[model samples]
Target chain A: MTKVTMTVNGKSVSAEVEGRTLLSAFLREGLALTGTHIGCDTTQCGACTVHVDGKAVKSCAVFALDVEGADVRTIEGMANADGSLSVIQQSFQDHHGLQCGFCTPGMVMASAALLADNPKPTEAEVRHHLEGNICRCTGYHNIVKAVLAASGQDVPAVAAE
Target chain B: MFNFDFVKPSSIADAVAAMAQTGAQALSGGQTLTPTMKQRLASPSVLVSLTGIAEMKGVCLGADGLSIGGATTHATVAAEAGAYYPALADLAANIGDPMVRNRGTIGGSVANNDPAACYPSAVLASGATVVTNKRKIAADDYFVGMFSTALDEGEFITGVTFPVPEKAAYVKFNQPASRFALTGVFVAKYASGVRVAVTGASNNGVFRWAEAEAALSANFSASAVEGLTVSAADLITDLHGTAAYRANLVKVLTKRAVAGAK
Candidate 1:
């Protein structure tokens, strides 16, 4: 077992885990923070997305030990200290960004990063930026809407599922 | 994933030393490796992860060229090296979703030598050097065959040394599910010659399209590749594409890439 230490959300987390333990595994298994989901083994799905050292990444593709001294952010930590939703979260909820919701957390994480960087992304930019996160339900009309809303803009329509 | 002794060495030297032992796999960006592991394709006894090694990070622009650390994520290259290596930067930035780009390392992509990958073609076309613990292999000499490299066991790539070119472009047709290329053409012009490296289309893995390269070498023009015909012989045929389709894509993508570069 290796001693893995890193900051989760805003809190420092340390755990003893196997070397084969992926970051998703550590978050879901060791830390019991199951908000990050693993939907595919081939790295195609963004369902396991999280932030490592401030950049959004797939938790399933990362090893727990890889982030020893790094800072990681997950879906569970996206809320304020008082337990209210963050701006991105509120936008997602208000715009009906989820249906099955399996891909919600990862989509939210990826979109949050995108909006943080490019606050007012165009529809093409939104489509291009969020290409990594795939959803099988509700198409992407509302997801795009959520992103636009988070950017403090009007919602988008006609993004067929 | 197979069971293994996992070790994340805190430094490059330690990572190298750890890989020096028998039956060890050096994990750079686990984007490729971990998936292979989870799928039971690779069952290494020891995993020497480079995540802890600070030396294998960053994108440094140099007087001669760009030297991206082995551990530098694709996102970093796509985000940082835009002015210098537009083809690579765009390809890296857009390879997978934001998640894969954040974790997938250029080193891992090059070392894994995925036949349908985007970076191999860029590395070969740009004449990048695979800087390793053992030796510096030229782009042509580094790639051996399918999922193979000149890198011997225990040898780890320190970083990739790429010389900036006069102009370059990479165009790929991706497999929707895996996001790997169905066929990718990376074209570049150097003082020596014009290089047209074709990945996703060779039984020999990544190879130079001689006919296409010769044409481009003469003029470095899109019209140079306009009439060239790529042979289907020796190109890979798999579920993603037929050998014939790939051969045709080699020519088509090459033309498109050249045009895109212009």
Candidate 2:
């Protein structure tokens, strides 16, 4: 086993996970941040999307040991301190972006990630950015709309180094 | 997932030492490995992570050519190295979404050598040299078969030196699920000769279409491949496509790739 120390959801958490323990596993099991989901194991279906060192990645495809000293944020940590949804999260609700809610949290996180990078993405750019995160429901029309709505408003930028 | 011991070595020596153990797997970007673990396809006894060992991380343009460190992620490859190897940069840039590209390492893709993998075609056609712990492998001899390489039991590629071709291009038909190439062609013209390599089409893994290459060698034009016929027996038949279809695509994509070569 390897011991990894990382900041997740702004909390420093450490775990002695096995070689096979994925970051998704670490978040769900070690830190109890279960917002990250695992839809597919082959890096398909970005249900396990999360932010590592402020860059979005599929947590399932990332080994926890790889991020030993990095910072990670899951869908659970996307809200403000007062428990209100982040701007992107609110936009998803307002635009009816999700259905069945299975892919919502990851979608929200990915949207937040995209809007953070390209605050004004063309429709094609938004489609390309969300390619990793698969939404079986709504055919992604509303999800694209939600992201466009969020992109109109300034989403919080990751802490600039 | 089945449990396995994990070790992060600080030095390249230790990293190589860790590979000496039995059933030990070297982890690069985890773009491929972790998923294999989750699917129970692989359960190595030990995973020697190459991330912390800073020695294997950098992109440098040297006298030899463009060399990308094994642990360099695809995003950086897309952003940084793409300027030098524009065609390769295009391949890296279009790999998956930004997240996969952020973590997916070129070495991981090259080492894994998935049949339809994009980098291998570029690496092969560019006449890249795969530097491993044991010895250097020419791209031609490196990829043996599907998901196979010339690496020995404990051998792993440390880096790759892709000779900047005069012109090169990678054109891929995506499987869409994992975004791997269903049929991809990487065509490159080097100082010696124009090399044509195809991935995701052959049954015995990546192979050079000697007929198309011979035709293109004579005349590097779209019309050159229009007259030739690729043998279907050389290609793979699967859910995505048939041997005949893949054979046909190899020609179509090759012409497109050669035209797109820059």
Candidate 3:
């Protein structure tokens, strides 16, 4: 077993886990931060996306031990200090960005990272940034809308092609 | 994934020493290695994490060329290398998604040499040097075959140095599901000559397209290779595309790349 220590969602936490334990497993099973869903065990789906050291990554594709001493942020920490939805989260709700909502957490995390990096991304850029996150409900139309709206861009009533 | 011992080495010397142990492997970004381990395809007894080594993690442009640390993530390269080499930066920006790019490393991508990876094309066309803890290998001599390299056991890459090209561009047709290249072409025009490397479409992995290279070297235009055709025998044929189809894509992407090169 390996002893891993890191800050998750603004809290300092440490755990003894197997060397092969994935960051997703550490966050979901060990820390009980189930907000970071694991839709696809493979890296193909970004359902387990989280921020490590301020950059978003697929939690399933990273080992917990490899993240020692790093700061990790998950979907659970995206709320305001008053415990209300953050801008991105509120945008998703207002835009009806999700249906089944299985992939919403990952989608929200990935969108937050994109806007942090590119504050004003184009429609094509927003669509491209979501390539890793798979939404089986085919609700990408509104997901894109929410991401764009969160970035303070005007969302067209009719989704642009 | 199976249980194993994990060791984070803070220096290149220590990393090399750790990897020298039996059943040990160097872990950079863990983008490919982690997924492979989860699938039980790889089960090394020891994982020597290289990210802790601060020396192996930056982008520096010098008289030699653009030197990028082996452990530097693709996102870092995309952001920092843009000022010097836009082609390399653009290719890095499109490697995976925002999440994958955040974790995937250039060294990991080149070392894995996935047929569909984007870095191999950039490394090959730019004629970069793979600098390992032991020695430097030219790009032409570094790539052996698909998912294989000239890197010796216990040896780990420290960084890769790319020479500035007179003009270059990378164009890829991504396979929708994985976002890996169905057919990608990188064209680099230098003062000495021209180089055209194709990835994802080759059975032998990333390789220089000599016919296209010669034509582009002579004319440096899309129309120069308009009549050229690549043999389908050595191209990859799978669910994504037939060998003949890939051969056609090679020609088309090369034309587009040349037309788009600065």
Candidate 4:
């Protein structure tokens, strides 16, 4: 077992985990921060996305031991000090971005990272940036709208086809 | 994943020493290796984390070319290499996603040598050199085949040096599912000659298309190889595409790359 220490959700946390322990597992099981979901287990699905050192990454694809002394931010940390939803999360709700909600945490995390990098992204850029984050529910129409809206862009409502 | 000892070494020498242990594997970024381990595909006895090593990180551009440290993440390359090598920056920026690029290192990618990986195409086409703890291996000699490299056991890749070319461009047809290149081409024009390396479409891994290179050398334009056909004999054929289809992509991508190169 490896003893690892890291800053998670603005708190210094330590855990004794096996070498095979994934960061997603550590966050969910060890620290009881189950907000970070693991959908596909494989790297293709972005359902396990989180931020490490201010960059979004798949927590399932990283070992807990490898992240020693690193800074990790999850969906749980994205709330305001008063426990309100962050702007991106609120935008998702306003845009009806989620249906099943399995992929929302990862989608929101990935979208937040994108907006952090590119504050004003075009619709095409938003779509391209979300290639890794797959949302089967809502057909991704609302998710794209939510990301764009969170970035302070005026997103038009989707017209019924 | 099997049980393994974890060691984070702050120095390359310590990391190499840790690797000397039986069944030890170096971990950088954990983008690829971690997944392999999670699936129980790789059962290493020890994981020597290279992320802690400060010496093997950063981008350095010099007279020789751009020297990228072994542990330098893809995001770093995408953000910093833009001023020096915009084509490389473009390729780096598009790899995986925001998260993969955040953690995946160029050294790990080249060392792992996945055939569909975008960096091998750029490295081979740019005629970069893979600098190791012991010696340097040219890009031509570095990659052997799919998931293969010339790196010996315990021989660490400190970084790679890419010689800035006169003009270079990388274009890839992304495989929808994994976002890996179905057929990627990197076309570079140097003072010496032209080098065109094709990745994700060949059975032997990333290789130089001599025919395209020679054609572009004669006339540096996309239309130069309009009639040139790629042979399907050595192309890769899987569920994604047939060998013949990949051959077509090779020619088409090469033309587009040449036209796109500035």
Candidate 5:
């Protein structure tokens, strides 16, 4: 086992982890940051998305030991300092972006990363960026609307939503 | 994933030394290796993480064209290689997805040489040089077969030097589910001649379409290869597509790639 140290959600934390311990396992099990879901452990689903050193990546696809001393941000960090829902989270909630909420953390994190890079993404750009993230519930219409709303763009109301 | 000792080396020399140890495997990006390990397909006693090596990360334009560091992530390539080689940048941009591209490295993809991968077609078509710690291998001799390369055990790619082509483009008909190429073609036109590489189709893996190359070199047009056909005898046949279907895609995508070459 290796002792790994990293900054998660702006807090420095240390954990004893096996070399095979994935970041998702480290977050959910070790740090009790269960917000980062692991819907598909095979790396196909984006339910495990998190930011490492400001770039979003699949937590399950990375080993904890590899990211030692790096800054990691999970879904738990995507909130205002007052513990209120972040703009993205509030947008997700208002736009009815989620159904079962299993994929919400990942969807929010991935969208945050996309907005960080391209703040004013178009409808097509939003859809393309979220390609890795799978949302079986809402058929992605509302989720796309939520992401656009989070980016401060005017989103059209979907009849289904 | 099996239990192992993880070592992140900050230098290429240190990484090389770490990889020389018994049962040591080089881990760059870990986009593919991590999943494979989860499936228990690869279990190395020690994993040498090469991403920490600062020297092996970046894209630079030199006399030889674009020299891309092996550990440079796909996102980096997509962002940096655009000015030097836009076609290559486009290929890197479309690889996997935003998250996978953030973690996947060019060296890892080229080294893995997955039959359906996108990089081999770019490397082979551009005739890039795969530079290793010990020696450099030409693209022609670097790729051997499916999931195989000329790299020796403990040897890892440090970078690749691509000679920028006058015109180049990569077109892939991806599997809808996996987004991997059902059949991808990369066409590169150099002053000397045109080189065409086909991936995700051939059983031999990422082979050059010589007939298409000859026709394109002579006429550099989509209609140049209208009469050409790839034999289905050597193409891959899987649930995604039939051998004949892939064979047809090879011709069709190659034509499209040539026509779209910029």
Candidate 6:
């Protein structure tokens, strides 16, 4: 095992990690940040998405040692300083973006990254940007709505939701 | 994944030295390698990550055309290569998803040379030069077969220089589940002639459709190759598509690529 150090969620954290330890495992086990989910260990599912140096990436596909001294962020860091929900998270809840909350963390993280890059993304753009993320429960109708709402765009309500 | 020692080198020389060690494997973006490791398919004793080398990143337009660092992420290529080579940028933009693009690098994809990958079609069709630590190789001689390349052990790609084409486009019929091409075609027209490369269709891996090239070079139009057909004999047949289906796609996509070239 080797000691890996990084700024996680605005805090400098260091841990002893095996060379094979994934960043998702490191965050969930080493630092005790369970907010980042791991639905699929493979790269297909985006449940393990997190921001490494301000860019969203699949934490499970990255070795912890590879991100040494990098700045990392998780869903836990999305809320305001008072710990209330951030705009994206609030929008997700308000729009019923999730049914099973398993994929929420990754969805929120990916959405936040999208808004950062393209603040006013269209409906097609949001769907395209979220191609990596999978949500079985919601059929992705409301999830797309939530992301649009988060971007301050007026989202039309679907009768199904 | 098997436990191994890890090293991140800040320079190419140091990275090469580290890779020269026994049982050391070079790791690029790890988009592909990490998953392979998790599956226990690849277990290196020491993983030498090449992302730390500052010099091996970014996209620049040189006298030859576009020079992209080996370690440069697909996202960077999508964002930067548009002005110089918009077709390449479009291909890069559509690779995998946003998160994967952020982590997957050009060198990793080209070096891994997955039969369904997108970059090899672009590289081979554009007549790009694969620059490595040891020497520069022409695209024609770089790719050997599926998941294989001309690269020897300890020799890693540093950058690739693509000769800008007068008109170029890449058209892919992606396997929706994985977003890899079921059969992709790239057509590039230069002053000298036309080059056509097809990926994801052939068992022999990415290859130039010489017949299509000759036809397109003579006419430079979609109708020029209307009568041409790819033989189904060497095409891949799997649950996703049949060899004949892939063979048909090779022709259809090539026509679309030529018509769409800008």
Candidate 6, chain A: TM-score against the reference: 0.96
- lDDT preference between candidates 2 and 4, better one: 4
Please give the fraction of native interface contacts (Cα pairs under 8 Å between A and B) kept by each candidate: 0.88, 0.90, 0.90, 0.84, 0.80, 0.88
> Compared with the true structure, what per-residue lDDT tens digits does model 5 show for residues A29-77?
9999999999989998999999999998999999999999999999999
| True A-B contacts kept by model 6 | 0.88
Clashing pairs in 1: A132-B97, A139-A161
Better candidate number, 4 or 5, judged by TM-score? 5
TM-score of each: 0.95, 0.94, 0.98, 0.97, 0.98, 0.98
In the predicted model 2, the residue pairs found to clash are none
User: Compared with the true structure, what per-residue lDDT tens digits does model 3 show for residues B18-61?
Assistant: 99999999898888888898888999999999888999999999
In the order shown, the candidates' DockQ scores are 0.77, 0.65, 0.86, 0.82, 0.87, 0.90
Q: Which stretches of candidate 1 lie over 4 Å from their true place?
A: A159-161
lDDT of 1 at B156: 82
Which pairs clash (backbone N, Cα, C closer than 3 Å) in model 6? none
The CAPRI class of candidate 6 is high
- Against the reference, the lDDT scores of all candidates come to 0.85, 0.84, 0.92, 0.91, 0.94, 0.94
- lDDT of model 3 at residue A94? 99
Pairs with backbone N, CA or C atoms under 3 Å apart (clashes), candidate 4: A56-B99
* Colliding pairs, model 3: none
Give the B-chain TM-score of model 5. Answer: 0.99
Per-residue lDDT tens digits for candidate 1, residues B91-128, read: 89768667788778888888899888888888899889
Per-residue lDDT, model 6, residue B75, is 99
True contacts kept of 1: 0.88
